[model samples]
Target: MRFTSGTSFDGVREQLFTLGEIPGVLWTPEGAVGTRPLIVMGHGGGRHKKDPDILSRAAHFVTGGGFAVVAVDVPGHGDRPKDVELDRIATENQARVAAGAELAPLIAGFQALVAGRTVPEWRAALDAVQRNGDVGAGPVGYWGVSLGCGLGVPFVAAEPRVRAAVLGLGGALASAADAARITVPVEFLVQWDDERVPREESLALYDAFGSAEKTLHANPGPHGELPAFERDSALRFFSRHLN
Candidate 1:
């Protein structure tokens, strides 16, 4: 991993890094030293590691919880070279949207394909993060939703370092088996009126998890309208399990 730039603000330190072409951002309390609990954040579709929402949440984890946070751009999603196949899929999805066609099927297939590539990238990034003196090998947590959740389910299943996760806004399509492999404690969110993901699919995804300790918080909203309090709750959840 190579750190290309960094800044300090609001008692938090932020660094831009690259791990073999994967662009990423790391956040920690200013002047932090030694190993600290880590939070690996996954952003939604069309968003990068340094996306605004990711940054806001990272700040909370760093300044409020004193946890180190890392977020990496998924393959074809940020600074990485675009994938021809993903571009083709995106074109098709755009056409489908113009035709008022259902987007779930196309998104399910596309997310499944991308997951095969990103899970390995996340593993490699974590390896590098652990080697960093400040982040070190400590309790790790994951927070992802929508596209993030779709990809993260498989990653958390394949990588054992993540002890807790905040996952939701995703369905079971292309993810049930991977979700079944995840045994870490999870705080799952669901929007009752999510137009993108059918309610049954989201509930089924929650049911698919193999974790003995998992909680579901279903609220009334669209896919992107999770209540703000959920974010606060999620940070507290991470603090409980990771700190």
Candidate 2:
């Protein structure tokens, strides 16, 4: 857990750090300390920990909800060395989808390969972050969608420290069993007209969760067009469960 740089702006402090090979970023209210809620985020496919959306949401969780938020680039993303095989397979999958091949099987196999490698990395990141006093022993939440959701299903289910989650923009083909193991509060999102994830599959993923307290929010949009307000809803969801 080596922080390479630190910066502060708008009452939120940002730190860029590396854990072994993983590149990650942490955000918290300025001068924060003691036990505070932590939100661990996973970026979507091709996105890094500090993309615009992720940075904005992390800032909100820090300044608006007064929570600590962190995100790490997972396998082949951000500053980590890319996997040639993963890239090849991803390109193949995209071409197959365009050729009218069924998306579920292709995506399922790809996500399985990625998730197997990522779950352990995420567990390590969570362990390191929580040990830092600013986030110590506090309730932890997870926010991830798309590739993040595929990988998160297993990580969150296996990690009891994650008390709540905001997951969506992915399907059940590869993660239904893990989803059933997640008993924490979850707020699952769905795009009514998602082109990448089939609607039935997304609904099925939400149904797979074992959490007694879970809510499903479906909006009309494509996979990349989630309404701006859903971001607010995610913050509120974390607030309700973590604080």
Global CA lDDT computed for model 2: 0.91
Model 2: which ten-residue window has the lowest total lDDT?
Answer: 103-112
lDDT of each: 0.91, 0.91
Please give me the total number of clashing residue pairs in predicted model 2.
Answer: 0
The residue-level lDDT of candidate 2 at 211 comes to 98
Q: Kindly give the stretch of ten consecutive residues in candidate 1 with the minimal lDDT sum.
A: 101-110
Using all chains and alpha carbons, the TM-scores for the candidates as numbered come to 0.96, 0.96
Instruction: Tell me the alpha-carbon RMSD of every candidate.
Output: 1.3, 1.2
On residues 1-243, what C-alpha lDDT tens digit does candidate 2 reach at each position? 999999999999999999998999999899998989999898888888998878988998898899999899877888889899899999999999899999877987898899898889888888898888888889999998888898888989999889999999889898999999999999998999999899989999999999999999999989967788988999999999999
Best by lDDT: 1
Predicted candidate 1 versus true structure: per-residue lDDT over 1-243, tens digit per residue: 899999999999999999888899889899999999999998999988888878888898898899999999987887878878899889988999899987777788889999999999998999998898889999999999999999999999999999999999999986999999999999999999999999989999999999999999999979978887888999999999998
